[model samples]
Target: MNLIETTYQLNQKAKHIAKVVSVDNATMTNIQLRAGEDIVEHSSKNDAFIIVRKGKIRFIVEGEPVVVTPENMLHMIPLEKHDLHAIEDTDLILIQIKP
Candidate 1:
């Protein structure tokens, strides 16, 4: 059996990004951001599923605003443009599936 630790420290006034898993078809990344942090507009080449584990984030996807929280997730198709703004100290798991 294999196990991976994905815990991250919260409340820090900094942005932390780490790749926790990588395989033939997919990858998982952990992103932790302090309140007021923002990820500038960008696009992904692969399909993406973002799981919000803690706090909240405001996502601008294709110019549309979407509020994501631990209550729900966000998904984007390949080449979709998006940006993220941390509404509070946030932690998220980003999964990308390659074609």
Candidate 2:
């Protein structure tokens, strides 16, 4: 079994922050955002899974707004337009898999 720690310090001075945590069979990324910061609408070529690790985030998927908390997650299908807004200081993991 592989164990990893996802703890990270938020860069309050930056509008957005992201880093690759691990990658092999798939790509895993750690993304952090301060309240009011957001990722602009975009689409991925691959499917993706997002897990809220610290706070809350609002995901606008295909023109629908969905609020996700630490206890919940969001999945994005390939080519789906989506955007993310930090409702509070938030940390999340994004796993992407090529189809």
Report the number of the highest-lDDT candidate. 1
Q: Write the per-residue lDDT of candidate 1 for residues 7-74, one digit (tens) a residue.
A: 77664448899999999999999999998999999998999999999999999999999999999999
TM-scores of the candidates are 0.94, 0.85
How does each model score on lDDT? 0.93, 0.83
For candidate 2, lDDT tens digit of each residue in 1-99?
667766566754554455565566578888888888889999999899999888899999999999988888988899999998999988888998876
- What is residue 60's positional error in candidate 1, in angstroms? 0.1
Candidate 1 Cα outliers beyond 4 Å, as residue runs: 11-13
* Candidate 1 least-lDDT 10 residues: 6-15
Predicted structure 1: lDDT? 0.93
